[model samples]
Target: MFRLNVTTLCAIKWDCVIVDEAHRLKNEKSQLYKACYQIKTRRRYGLTGTIMQNKYIELFNVFDWAAPGCLGPREHFLEYYGEPLKQGQRISAPERFVRIAEERKQHLVKVLGRHLLRRTKQETIGHLMRGKADNVVFCKMSDLQIQAYRRLLRSPDFQLLISKDLPCTCGSHLTRVECCHRTAPDGVIWSYLHRENPDGCECCPLCIVLPCLIKLQQVSNHLELIKPSSKDDPEKQKKDEQFASAALGEDAVLVGGLQQDESFMGMSDAQHCGKMRALEKLLETWLSKADKVLLFSCSVKMLDILDRFLVRKAYSFCRLDGSTPMGVRQTLVDSFNNSPSKQVFLISTRAGGLGLNLVSANRVVIFDPNWNPAQDLQAQDRSFRYGQRRHVTVYRLLAAGSIEELVYSRQIYKQQLFNIGVNGTSEKRYFEGVQDSKLYKGELFGISNLFRDLLETVFTSEIIENHEERLTGIHRTSSEQCAKQGLLGEHAVSSKLEIEDDIENSELSALSQEQDGIEDEIESPNDTQSCSESQYEHILKDAGVLYAHRNEEVVNLGGAVQKHKRPKTKEQICSMNDPKTLIPSFVVDEHQRLATPSTLKILSENGQEDDTVGQKRKYEEIFKLEEMDETTKWFLSGSSLCPTQSIDCCKAVFK
Candidate 1:
C-alpha cells in the first residue's frame, strides 16, 4: 500500500518492523541485516519459512536484530555450535544447532511475542491463487554462444583464474605458453614478455596469456574479411601466400593473428539479441500499465537485458549494479524521487538491497528468486516501505520446475528453521533430520520455461484474437489510410501555410526597407567599401600595427649642380707661419699690461725712451749670459743659432 511505502514507513516511526522471508537477514555480518538491526524501533518482526539453510550462524543476523544479546558474540556462538574439520571437507554444526534453535525460538517469543506477527501464505492468502505460480525451464543456447563458450573452455590460458588466484583444478607448474597444449612458440613468448611483461613472477599464464590470446583470435577472425587476399590480384598473390606461410608457422602466431583481426564492430550475436529482445518486450508490456516496478534476478546479466529495453524505450531510469560507483547511488535515488518522468530503477540486490529508500513505487516484481529469502525481501522492501499508499502487489516471476525452484524452496525452508529452532541437538542431526521432500516442494519451479511458453499465450490473448476488428478500422495502404482520414490534406495545408507566411513576411520586409531608403543604402557600393576599409584598418591596428598601407608614393626633383673649386694647397697656407704673425700683439704686451703705473712713470721720468731702454736692458742681460761658459751661455740664450724656418716660406719667397 502507498501508506506502507518506504518514505511513509520511515516517517510514521512504527513501533515494530516486520520483515517477511526473514532468513535473508541470517548473516549478521551482512550490510542489510546490520542496517535493519540499527533501525530505531521498539519491536522487530521477521516472517520466514526457512531460516538457516546453509549454516547456524545465519540465525545470528535475525537474533541480532530481534534481541542483540540473545545470540552472544559471534566467536562464543561459533565455539558452542560450530564444527571444525580437516581440509577438503565441509564443516557443520547440526547437532549443537538444533538445540540452540529451540532455545532461541523460545527466548524470541518470550521477549518479542507481543509485537511479532507472522503467517504463511497458505494460512492467510492461499485462496488468492489456484495452487502456486507455474514455472517453465528451458536450456537454450545459440550456436554462437556455445561456440564462444567452447572456445573459452578449450583455451589453455585461464587468465581470470590465474590472475585473480581463483580456484583451478588444473595442476601444472609450466606457464600456459610452455604447456604442451599451448601453441605459442618460445619467440612469441619473448615478444609478449618484451611488450607486456607481468608485474611480478606471481602472475599465472592462464590468466594473462590465455585471455589475451582468445581476444586476439576473436579479433583476427572478425577482421579476416578486411584482410587483403592473394586471389584479389596476381601481384598480391605472392605476398598473401608468404603471409599465410608465416602465419601457419606456429599455432600461437596463427591464433594471435586471427584474434587481432576479429571485428566486434557493428556485429551482434543473434542469440543474445533475440533473448534480450524477448525480455524487453515482456518488460515493455508490464511497464506500460505499472506505475512503479521492481525487477530482481540473481545474475547481473538479466539486469543488462532490462537495461537495453529501457534504453530502446527512451525511459529515464537508474541502475544499481555491482560496478556502480558508490557516490552516484544517492544522487540516482534523489533523481528518481524528484522526477516523475523517470520510470524504472534497475537495482542489483547485493549492492542496493540495504540502506536504500526506494518507497516511490507501490509494485514490486522479482525476476527470479535466489536461495536467500532475506535478499528477496530486502529487494521487495525497496518499494514496500512506509510511504507506499497503495496496496503493494509483489510479483515473483519464476521459471517453474527448474534449479531456480530448488533455490527458492531451500530459501523458504531455511526461513522456517529460524521460526522453529533446534533444542540441544547435534548440528549434523539437525540437518539430517530436515525433511528434504517438504523443502524441495516449495521451490520456484520452471520459471524460465514458463515465460518462454507464455509468449505465445500473451500474443494470442492480447493481439491475434482481436486482429480482425482492429484491421477493419483502417485501409490497407498506410498513405491511403492517412488520405482517407484527411490527415494527409491537413499536413499538406499546414506546410503550405507555413511557406506562404514566410514568403509574405519576406516581401513585406523588403518593401518597408525600400520605402525607408534602407535598401538603397545597403546596395550602395561606395558606402560599403568605405565601411569595409575602415573596418580593415581598425582590425590591423588592433592586431598591433601602427601603420598599414597598400601602395607606395615617390616624388623626384631632377637637377644637376656645378662642382666646387679645390681649397688652397697646404704649402701656401704654411708660408705665413711667422711667430709675430702667428702670435697676437696683446699676448706680446701681456707683461706691459701687468706693470704698475709708478714703474711706467719712473721709466718715462728718467727720460729713457721706451725702445732704447728695452734694447739696452736686453743687451745687458745677453752680455751677462755670455760671461758664463759656452754651455751655460747656450742654455741661457733666448734665441737658437739654427734659424731655419718652414720650407713653405722659402718656397713662397723664392717663387
Candidate 2:
C-alpha cells in the first residue's frame, strides 16, 4: 500500500533495476520484492543464473511486478494448482500451475529481454587469464566463537534443556509418558560431569545416551536446584518417598529417548582461517586482470577479511556495508565509477545493492551467496545496467558443500515457491513442518559442505599454479618498466639567477663615497675638536679641489666673520657684572676691531688697570673722555649692528 513520491519515481524512470540472485525474490512477502515493486521504471531487469529453483512460487513476487496481475492471487491459484497435505507433508503443484508459471516467465522474458542481461563468467569470459582462483579450507574456529559455542552447549543451565526439564528432579513421581523432562545426556556434558562430580546421584545416573542428551540432563538438573521451593520453611525437605519414586519412574521411562548429537565441536578457528586464506588468494588472482570489480558478500565480517587482504596487497578500493551512511553511499558509487586507479569496490549486498549504478565495471564477484536470489541479482545489476559497454561477467564464488551451499539450495527452492504463487501462510506452514528436522540436524559441526568446497580447489592444483604464474609475470613487469623511466631530467635545477653585463661598478663606488662624505659632514661637529691642524689642512685641500671643479659662489671669510659680530658699544663696561657684553659674539671680529695699535693700547691698559683699581676705573676713564664731545662720543658709540648684514664697525670706532 506504500506509495513512492513522484520525484523519486521520476528519478528511476530510465535507470535499470537488476535483481541479483533472482531466486531470492521467489517469496512475494519479502521486503526486497515489495520495495522493487514500488520502483517506477521502464527498463527493468533481473540477473540470476539459477532462475528456476526448488519451488515455482519463488518467482511470484518478481513476475508480479515485471508483469503485474499476470500471476493469479494466492488462494485462487493454490486452489487450482496445489494439493492439501498434513504436517510434515509437502503439497505438490498441479500441471496447470506449472504451465501458468512457465508462460508468465516466458512472457516476462519477451517483454523485458532487451533490458535484462545475465552471463556467467564461465560462459562469457572463459577462464580468467591474469589471476589465480585459490581455495583454502581452515578447520578451526576463532577463539571467541569456540568458547561461546562450548559455553552454550556445555553449561548445565542452557535455556533449551532447562525448559524441557530433562533431568527429572522430583525424585520420580510422574510417569515417563507425562514427564516433560525426557532427553538423553550428551557426551560433552557427561564427560565434564563425570570428571568433576564423581559421585553420581540416583537422578544423575550415567547413561549411554547422545552427547546432546547429557547436555540437556545437566541443564535440567541445574534448573531443578534453582527452582523455588513450595513450603514457607527455609529448611523444609521433601519426605514423600513415593514422590521420589514417581520422579524416578519418569526418569527411567525418559532415560532412553533420543536427541540431537554434539557434532559442532569440530568447527575450529584453524579451519576458518585456512578457508578464508584460500578465498583471499582466489580473489587476488581474479583482481589481477580486472580494471574494475565488485565483490559482494552477505557477512560484513567476511567483507572485512577481504578488505584486509586487499589492504595487504596494496590494492585501492572502497567498502560499503549496512552501517554506511546514506549520504556517503552515493559518493562511494561515484568514486568507483570515475576512479581508474581503484580496482575493487567491496560492498555488502544489503547496503550497496539497490539504486547504485556501477556499469563502468564489467566484472562482478559474489564472495558468498545468500538465501535470497533477488538480493544477489540486485547486487549484480549494479554493473550490468544501462550504459554498460562491455558484456558484464559475474563470478559466483560458492563454498561447494558447506552451510553456504545448503542455504543456496534453499534459495533455489524458495524461487520455485515464488513461481507457484504460494501464499505466505502456506510458506510458513511448510517452514514450520521442516524447521526442526531440515534445519537442525545432529552434527559435530555442520561444515562438511565447507570442507568439500575447499577440497575442490585443493584437488585442482593447476588453477592455483596458473594463477601464481600469472601473478608473478604481472608483478615482475608492471613495476620495473615504470621505474626505468625516471621522473625528471638530469640537468633540472630548482632556481636560476641571471646576471646583466651593463651595470658599472665605478658608479656604485662613487655613490658609496658620496654617502661617506654626507656621514662625515653629519659628524663634523665632534671631529672639529678632535682633528689636528694638519688634518684640517688636508680637509681644506680636498674642499679646494671640489670647489675648483664647480662654478661655486666664493664666500669672503673676513666679510662673513664680520657679519656675525655685534659691534661693542663704547658706553658699555666689559666686566663680570656685564658678562654678556664681555663675551665677544665673534672672535674674528673682536680681534679685527682690536687689531689697531691705539685700540690694543686701550685694551692692554684696561687689563693692566684691572690689577690696580679694577676694570671699572678703565671703563670710567673711557666714558669720562667720551662725555666731553657729544657728537664725537655719539659717533664713537657702537649701537648700529646687524649680525647677518654687512656692519660699518670700523668707521664707527675710528671716528
Local distance difference test values of all predictions, in order:
0.39, 0.39
| lDDT for position 168 in model 2 | 44
What lDDT tens digits, residue by residue, belong to model 2 across residues 24-113? 566777776666677766556666655544444444455556656565675643333332221112222343543354344334444333
Provide the clashing-pair count of each candidate structure.
Answer: 88, 76
lDDT of candidate 1 over 1-655, digit per residue (tens)? 4323445445556687778767778776666665565566777777765455555576555666677766678776555433221000111224354335434444544443333344443335433322211111111222333233334323323222223332223666754334432222232232344345433233434334533433322221222322234346754444333333333333324323422222332122222322333334434544565465555555564565456556656777788888888898899888877777777788887778776777666445566565666677667667655554433445454322223334444454454343333321111111112332232211122212111122112221122113222222221243344346554344333432332344345346544632432211111132211123344333322322211110000000000011112213544333323222221222212212212111122122112223322322232232232233333322222232221232223334433
